[model samples]
Target: MRILLWHVHAAWTTAFLQGPHTYLVPVTAERGPYGRGRAQTYDWPASCVELTPAELAGADVDLVVLQRPEEWALAARWLRRIPGRDVPVVYVEHNTPRRDVPDSPHPMADRDDVTLVHVSHFNDLFWNAGGTRTVVIEHGICPPAAEYTGELDRVGVAINEPLRRWRVTGTDLLPRFCEVAGLDVFGIGAGRLRGLLPPGTGLYDDPPQHELHRQLARRRVYLHPMRWTSLGLSLLEAMMIGIPVVALATTEAVEAVPPQSGVLSTRVDTLVEAVRWLIKDPETATEVGSRGQAAVRARYGLDRFLAAWERLFKEVAPCMSTPSTAR
Candidate 1:
């Protein structure tokens, strides 16, 4: 099947494109948000091809997977075709509610033209996607090489634009966790809080996915303190990398992380204690991390994710082949 989607979430897109389909991503002369083409920093498959707006105008796309609200207008202008009207479409909502809970109106609300896909069930329950058909396809990871060493005693956390999204990303709480052990933070704008962060904090800019996983695997424990947002991909990656996780039981996280995997609680103190314990007992950390590794692989395998997506695609776009996951 030929699928057209904007290059928005690179990590999500990278895993999505691994499916057995031709993925056409828009590319401009000067790559920006709308047209990042292919990931330069991360390795992606050749099947995920880059096509200009002009080329896409004549391209045969079975379905247009829309991520952003503006992409609907952009698709119509670029493809000279209306999304969901002239072409089948699936709008994927990656984040949680922006304004208020159960009251925040989705941008594509009250639409029957396209199927709204929520990455997590928690997001589907919260967002009011009126009139639009909604489905839950929990996140899945294309496993990176098993690299968890637990050799480093520092705590690892990944966040983007930490200062700007301080509260949402739980950036202000970094100091609290710093007292447990040294911290190695990775993501966009992570280095901005060098002065404000505690002495144990070490910041790194956005690194490639492989490197991110490799570095994160070295940490004794992975910290996920996001207070408001959808389930982060980093947490899942850390689990897949066999890193013992210590996350706040918020949003979809409550459902995602089981007790046996690591330690998840609403109390930050409990989380800090768990991390300190993991640091002290590397063997116990590895045992707990192994449970998370097994659980994540069983639940969020690439094949399962792609199969679920294929089932959804078959529903909206009749031209697609039978989905093995579909009943």
Candidate 2:
């Protein structure tokens, strides 16, 4: 299959591109948001190729995967073909609705043209998709080769644009965890948190995937402070790296973190206490983390993720033929 998609979510796209498909990512001279081509921070497969808008017009794209609403119009303009009408289309909703909480209607709600794919059941429940077809495909990742050392007693967190997302990302709640142990934050815009956080908190801005995984494993416990989000891939990555997690009992965190694997609670104090205990008790932390690693590996295996996508693709475009180059 030949899939047309933008380089929107690098981590998710990296996993998706691992399947037996030829992925077409748009690239511009400026390398803007919509045209990032292949991922530089994370490794993607060779099957993922970059093409300009003009080049794509001639490329026979078999399927279109939309991430944002604006991409609907962009697809029509760039390919000169309307999605759903001209080619099979799937919109992967990566974020939870920001407005009106549970009552907020999804931006793509009631749109019969495109099928909506949610990353978590929490997102599926909160979003009012109306009559639009919807399905939940939980996050999956290739487990990192690095094993957890937990030599550092610091807490590790990964979030993008934390200052701007603030409360939504649980950035404001970071200070509470900092008191328990030093923190090491890794992500885009993380460098800005240097002076703002306490003396112990260390900030690493947009480190490459290999470095990020290495740094995360050194921390005693992984902290997820997101108040609202479609389940974060970083959380899954941490678990896969054999790091015990402390996250709020909200959204998909409730489901992702299995029993005896990690601690989850609505109360910030409980989570703080859990981290404090986990930091002090390395033996218990290792045990818990191992359980998490086992559970996540079974639930979100790359094979399972790719198979689900394959089933969906077949349903959407049963008649579409596979290219010779596609796996």
Instruction: Name the best candidate (by TM-score).
Output: 2
Q: Rate the local accuracy (lDDT) of all candidates.
A: 0.89, 0.91
What's the lDDT for residue 213 in model 2? 95
In model 2, residue pairs whose N, Cα or C atoms come closer than 3 Å (at least 3 residues apart or on different chains), thus clashing, are none
lDDT per residue (tens digit) for residues 128-201 in model 2: 99999999887779778789999998899999999999999999999998887988899999998878899967
Q: What TM-score goes with each of the models?
A: 0.96, 0.97
RMSD of each: 2.1, 1.6
| lDDT over C-alpha atoms for residue 41 of model 2 | 93
Q: What digit string (tens of lDDT, one per residue) describes model 1 on residues 59-92?
A: 9888999999999999999899988888999999
Q: Alpha-carbon error at 55 in model 1, in Å?
A: 2.0
